[model samples]
Target: MDVAVEVEDLWFTYPGSTEPTLRGINLRIERGSFTIIAGPSGCGKTTLCRCFNGLIPHFYGGTLRGRVLVNGIDVASRSTHELAREVGMVFQEPEDQLICLSVEREIAFGPENLGLPTEEVKSRVEEALKALRIEHLRDKAPFELSGGEQQKVAIAAALALKPSVLVLDEPTSNLDPVSALELTKALIELNEEGLTVILVEHRLDLVARYADQVVLMDRGAVLVQGDPREALSSEEALRLGVAVPKPIRLFKQLLVHGVKLARPPLTSEELAEGLVEFLGRHRG
Candidate 1:
């Protein structure tokens, strides 16, 4: 497989803390795949993501062991600035990443800080704005935009660097349902264009069906990881409060009552199809 990010026996501990936050994590995320990293709170999901862009031991000052590679480069070997060219990170809170006054400036900030030529920076800014389809908001200030708009601006800023990978941590936590769905669709569109997306989120109902792979982490380690159907349906994941999508959960209960789907369904649409097929067969 063409791997975008690889973690081998990774371990990390925060400064002034005794217990490690991440423990013996081994994972491989394929190129151009939409992968979701999910689990209960404090399962080290965010910390593990930090390792993807050289933020763990580099910026957070922690004890890091094992190896983490992004786009075939060792994360510990490069500065965050260096990796920013290869991996763009969007945090849980869009406001935390937004500092510029205007939307265009927010998108341009990264390339400008990278010291790209004037025309190159401007070109990148325009490309990012167009990519996110936010050209109409170019003149507005970030503080004036909605939560979803700010998140889009943050993503656009990250894209301005022209990175091959995008890692987001619970990006929809603050948005309304409509905005969250819109953001999710935007990310899906980006992934369809071959950008490797690693989304750290708990809203399985919103994204589980769209992921190529689902990784369930718990207590600072990966408890289950594989195809979404298998990973999210794992008894271990469900027992650990991984928040399996409602459709999947409902079907599991149906199976216990002697109603089995040809396969597990990840979304409501799939669940409905399964039932329809089952009913037709019975009537026939």
Candidate 2:
């Protein structure tokens, strides 16, 4: 197994904070897998993501214990610039990450900063823009675009770096439902293209549909991490305020109502097919 990220007994604390934000965290992410880190507010999801990109101990000053390796490089030993090339990050708010004047400049900023050849930067910018389907907005000012458009531009900028792993924190928190769906589809497409994606999001339904693994956290500790189906179906997930997909909830309800199904459905499509089979069996 090609490992993209590895953390062992990680611990972190902010200046003047009474309690540590993370405690003895251990996690490993496989290359090319889509994983979601989910928890309620203040559960250290964002803090853990920052560590993945070397933001916690590097950017923030505090006592750090443990090791975080990204693409075989120890995060604590690598500089922020070096880590940025290996792990691209997209924040919850696009405006927070967008510093360039236009979409094209924003996307090209990373490669340019790395001092790549002009042609290479141009090629990467074009590819990133095309991948996100935001070529039409290439010339538009970052401030002038809609929330979804801004997020797409942010993701494009991250992609331009060509990082082995992409870490996104609440990418869909501010978007409308339609925009959220659009962003989710784009993320799924990126994951399909072999980019390792780690997202910290509260929207369970969106991530449940595509996430290969799910990490449920609480009180600055990992509660469970495994295949999304197994982890999300556990009772601990329900007790921690993590939202369950509607299909799974519905399946459980039907099971309680005497409907016999072989497995709990994870998506609407699965639920529909299960219902069809159940009806067919009854008719027979």
Candidate 3:
């Protein structure tokens, strides 16, 4: 698999701040992978996500020691505009990016700013809307859409820029349960279509089922990162206050009671299947 993002010995301190937010961080995100980043608040999750898109040293003046690479290009040296082509960052609040009047215009806004030809901009807008399945909402005003639709438009706008990697920081925090689930399904489809996705979310139950890799962070460093079942179910991650998915947690609790399963499950459906198989083996 191609490497999408690489970080080496990264450390950074914001302007007018004495302490660093990230300390000696190292990570590698493979292309077309879906990665979930989890940890308690203020554990440098946001700061690290910023590095992926050159927001660390480019937009925010900070003392950065180390290197961040996106698609094999050094992030520290690239301008934010340059990085935007390769990494699309969607913040916690989707409203922060919905500045345009209509969904199509919103998607067109980024390419237009990049000075692309009018035809190219229109083409990108059309592709983004269709790719996101938001074509029905194209001509509608963004403010009038539902929360889920609004977030979809925001993601479509980011996709219009043709980024290879999409970094979302707590994207579903503000949405209702149904909206959050809808957004999660959309992200999974996007990742399946080969867009590398890095999500920093607290709602494990919502996205854990779709994760290809799980990363746990704490106190300005990555505690552990690996296969979702292994990393999310470990005792170490739970000790650090990282919230594992409920179904995965149940598997862990079962293991403590001398009930051994062949493998941990990442979703409710998997957990149910595992339990049935286990019970069949130990039939009373």
Candidate 4:
């Protein structure tokens, strides 16, 4: 399989900190996969993302020992300008990343920085806006949009760069529940369209239904990584404070209530089917 990101024995520490935030971490993400990195705060989920896009050892100063490769280029060796083409990062706070006066310009900024032709940039800007279903907000100032709208605009901006991999750090952290769900749906659609997505989020319930792979981290180290079904089923995930999907947890609880099912259900639809079978078997 084509690898979109590779981290080998990666380690990093901030300037003032005596201990390293990340330690000997290794992971590989396949191209076009939707992967989630989930864990409690300070577990290095965000730090690991920085390495994926060359922000750690490049933009932030620290003692770094390891190799982080994105799209086959070593992050240590690539400039931010070079990495921007292959990897687009959407920060937790959109305000920190947004600078363009209008939503359209914000989406257009990255493509413009890549020195894309005026016509090509325009095409990408339009396509990105359409993809995120935000074309209506094009002419409005970014500051005027709602939190969810701002995030969509931020994502649209990242998309405009046409990156092979997109890393998002808690993209839905600041939105209302409805907006969060909408953004999650948009991200799932993007993944279906074949963009490799790496998400760092605490909202496990929102992502559990859509994630192909889950990477559970703790104290800057990977605790588990695998298919979402297997990974989320592990006790370590719960013990580490990684958010558990309510449906999956509810399924497990039903088992405690003497309900029997063939398999643990991860989605509401599956859970409903399991309940039907359990009730029918008990009735018979």
- Please tell me which predicted candidate would have the highest lDDT against the true structure: 1
Best candidate (score: TM-score): 1
The lDDT, on a scale of 0 to 1, for candidate 1 is 0.92
Cα displacement (Å) at residue 282, model 2: 7.5
Q: Write the per-residue lDDT of candidate 2 for residues 139-205, one digit (tens) a residue.
A: 9999999999999999999889999899999999999999999999999999999999999888888
lDDT of 4 by residue, 1-284 (tens): 89999989999998788999999898989999999999888888888888887888888888899899888899999888888889988988888888889998998888888888999999999999999999999999988999899999999998888899999999999989999999999999999999999999888888887888999998988989888877887898879877788777887787788886777677888889988988888895
Model 1, stretches more than 4 Å misplaced? 279-284
- What would the TM-scores of all predictions be? 0.97, 0.95, 0.95, 0.95
Candidate 3's displacement at residue 193, Å, is: 0.6
Candidate 2: minimum summed lDDT over ten consecutive residues — where?
A: 258-267
What does candidate 3 score on TM?
Answer: 0.95
Residue pairs clashing, model 2: none
Encode model 3's per-residue lDDT on 1-284: one tens digit a residue.
Answer: 68999999999999999999998988889999999999999999999988999988988988999999999999988899989999998888777779988888899999999999999999999999988788999989988898778888989998999999999999888999998988899899999999999999999888887888898888888888889889988877789887777887788889889888778888788988898899999999
lDDT of each: 0.92, 0.90, 0.90, 0.88
Local error of candidate 3 at residue 191 (angstroms): 0.6
Superposition TM-score, candidate 4 onto the true structure: 0.95
lDDT of 2 at 154: 94
Report clash pairs, candidate 4: none
